[model samples]
Every structure is written in C-alpha cells, then in structure tokens.
Target: MRLIPLLALWLCLTCQSALAAPVRVLNIIVGEWPPFVAEQSKQHGPVAHLIRDLFKEAGYEVKFHFAPWGRVYSLAANSQLYDATAVWMYKPEREQDFLFSEAVLQEQFVFFSLKARKLQAERLEQIIGMRLGGDIAYSYGPELDKMVADGKVTQQKVTDVKQNFGKLLRDRIDLYPQELRVGLAELQSQLDPASAALITHSQTPFLRNDSFVMFPRKMPDSAKLRDQFNQQLQQAIASGRYQRYFERLARGEY
Candidate 1:
C-alpha cells in the first residue's frame, strides 16, 4: 500500500512538469546600449534581464542580436528581416512598426568634449562649428537638429560609440554627443580603459530625459507580449527589485 501511494505521487509530479507550457520567441535585433542592453553578454544589462524575465513569465522565448542602432530601427520598421529590438527612443514615425510596452526606464542625453577645445556650451548655440559625433539616425532634439541644419554644428555619423570614443581619444572630434549613463557603460564595455578614459561627459544635456524599450511589430504575439511586459514591469518597479541591479552598475558590476 505504501509503495502504491508513492508511485502515484511520482506520476502526478511528472504529469505536472510535462504539462508546463513553452514559449516560442522570434529573433530580436538590438544595439549595445549599455545599462540597457550590452551585446557582449546576452544576460548583461538591466533591460535585457527584465525583457527575458517578463516574456518568460508570459510563456514566450526570446532571442536578441546586436548591431548599430540604425539597423535595429530598420529591422523593427521592416519586420521582415528581424523580429524585435531594445531601448528605442519613441519616434512618431516608428509608431506603426513597433508594439511598445510602457517604458522600462528613462535615459538622459550628455556630451563629451575635449577640454583643450574650450568647447563650453550652456546652450545649443555654443556648440556651433564643432564636429559632433554620434551613431547615425539617432535623434538629437529640435535645437541640435537646427544646429546641424544650419551648419552651426558639424555632424559626424559613426557606426558605434566604441569607434567614436577612439576618435575622441585621438582628438579627431570635438565632442561625442550622447546620454550620460548609457555612454559610460558602452564605453566601459566595448573599449579599453586607455581609449574609454579620453572621453568625458560635460553633463550639459541636449535632451534631458527620454524613454525606451524592447519592441516587436511583426509577431502575432505583439499585443500579448506588450501586456505581459507591462504587468511584470509594474511588479518590478513596485517591489524595487530592479534598483539592486543599478546599484551593481554603480559598482562596475556590468
């Protein structure tokens, strides 16, 4: 009698395990926007971790690929070549392509200048005539765009922050216009200290705060995934579960 009961319990456990559902995630394309998504380690950043957990809870598999931000945007827009990407700044034109959940975090814009250039600018006008380095297709706001259009600030479009930081170290450009936290992490992850140290954020933001995310357009699970993410995100924020990771970021945990 004892053996019969034990056998039944074992079978029940096996059945429950077998009944667990599996999630099928499509390929996602993203860029190495550190503290958000670091390409080197798929599991490295906060956003990446949040994305993995949220979708997993919702019973979906996830796959992420890293490249230049322009390509990531293109993939999300077209939807044929790739399935999703992370940390996209909200653009009105892109609203059609991506099914975005509520933002996971807000990013701040920052500028890195060569001290010798005397490139001090309290406002947009001060950056006139200096070469501003950035990834192609990124938004710099109305003031910066106006400067670029008027030829007040010479714009240099590069493939990634790694290369641009090299240029900054070499004094090839005046400033690397970027977000403070993201820039620091990208620099630290992709470049050696010798090269990364050359750039310094001036803390003068062209755009102070912007929201971003993991976005999917082509997938049938688009709406479902967004809802799942939002639900999990709310829980994470409420519990202060995510702040521990940022503390690691401060301690160079990435």
Candidate 2:
C-alpha cells in the first residue's frame, strides 16, 4: 500500500540519521605569536588558519582557546585542559608528554636589538656577558639552554614583546631572541614606525626550529587523532594545499 511505502521511507530516514557518526570536536590551546597565532585576527592569524583548515579537511571540529603563552603551555601539558596546543617548539621533554604532529612550520630564531647597539652576532658565544632579553617559558633550543644554564650567557626575563622591545631600546638588555617573522609583525603592529625602524634582528640565525601541533599524551584519543592528522598534514604539504595559506599570508588576507 501507499501508506506502507511512506512508513518504510520514514523508517529508512530515521535509521540513517541514527546511524550517522557524531562530529568529533578537538579542543586546542593557543598563545599569542603573531603572523602565526593571535587572538584578534580572523582565523586567528594565518598559521592557525591553516591548522584549522587542516583539521576541517580531516573531518574534525576544532575549538581554540587563546591564553598567555605560559598558561597555555601549562594547561595543555599538565591538567589535560586541552586535547592539543596549536604549536610549540619540540624538545625531548615534550616528547614524553606529547605526540607532536609533523613539522607545521620552521622558525628562524634571531636576536633583535636597537640598531645603534650593533648587536650582530652569528654565534651565541660571541655575545656572552651581555644581557639578552628572553621570555622565561620559551625554548631557544638545547644548546642555548645549556649556555644559559651553565652561566655562559646572561638573560634578562621579560613577560612579553612590548617589554622586550622597551628593555632593548633602553639598554636594559642588549639583544632579544625571537622568531624573525614574529618579531617583524610585532615591531610593525605594536610600535610606532620610528621606534620600530630602530630595531633590527641579527643577520645570522641562532637556531632554526620546526614548530608542530602538540597532542597531550593523556588524552585517550590522542594517538589515533594524531595519526589521522599526521596523514592529512602530509598530504596537504605534498599536494600544495598548505601553500595556499601562505599565499593568503602574502596578500595580508589571512
């Protein structure tokens, strides 16, 4: 009968709806690192935009929480407050607690200084005894860490970029190490043109580090999710899907 056919179709539709898989939403923590990750920008800046796109491509939902760098790392690493962190520099210590995705980006670590200071240096040892500005929580790689730990070099701690730039300009610190692109973005946006013009980074890089999305080990789904993301990331990189994000970056659209 016509009524039987209608009921059959209704049952089929209900079964399909009931059998559909639920969307997976991954919570991620992010810190302020401009031209890459920032709270104010649409898509949370280009790097983050790419990250969001990558996960979307993998059929996962993403929720981003922006906080101070130190707090973000603490929450992501300790309390399992998030399933992952947007990006972080890889270190052996992190490996024990995190399943890092394939390299998402590379950061050229360099020193920023007042142009008048003439603080150009190709080597960390070359600038020993001078006060270097650094964030307490950041890693400048193992070699620089050892140098600081052994007291071979001195570092003055500042909480954020504004303070770093202020101290460098006042001679409170001679040089500050920051990712080149991050420093450039901060200089242009946070400081007046004249002030920004006075600051320049070292001609030589102190280190180059690959950044990655860090999945906390405690998450029950961490390994599986990481594997899924890894596969998609590899494909994105290989097929040039990821490069489109940078193209948007070049156009200031991101």
**Against the true structure, what is every candidate's RMSD?**
3.3, 1.4
Clashes of each: 2, 0
What TM-score quantifies how close candidate 1 is to the native fold?
0.82
User: Model 2 over residues 13-108: C-alpha lDDT tens digits?
Assistant: 999999999988888998888888888887998888888888888898888998878787778878876888978898888888899999888889
The deviation in Å at residue 34 for candidate 2 is: 0.7
Give candidate 2's TM-score. 0.95
**For candidate 2, which ten residues in a row score worst on lDDT?**
116-125
What lDDT does candidate 2 reach at residue 52?
A: 81
Give candidate 1's whole-model lDDT. Answer: 0.73
Q: Model 1 over residues 132-248: C-alpha lDDT tens digits? A: 788887877666877888888888888877778878878878878887887877776778876665556765577865565645666666676677778977887789876766676
Name the best candidate (by TM-score): 2
> Best candidate per lDDT, number?
2
Residue 13, candidate 1: Cα error in Å is 8.3
TM-score of each: 0.82, 0.95
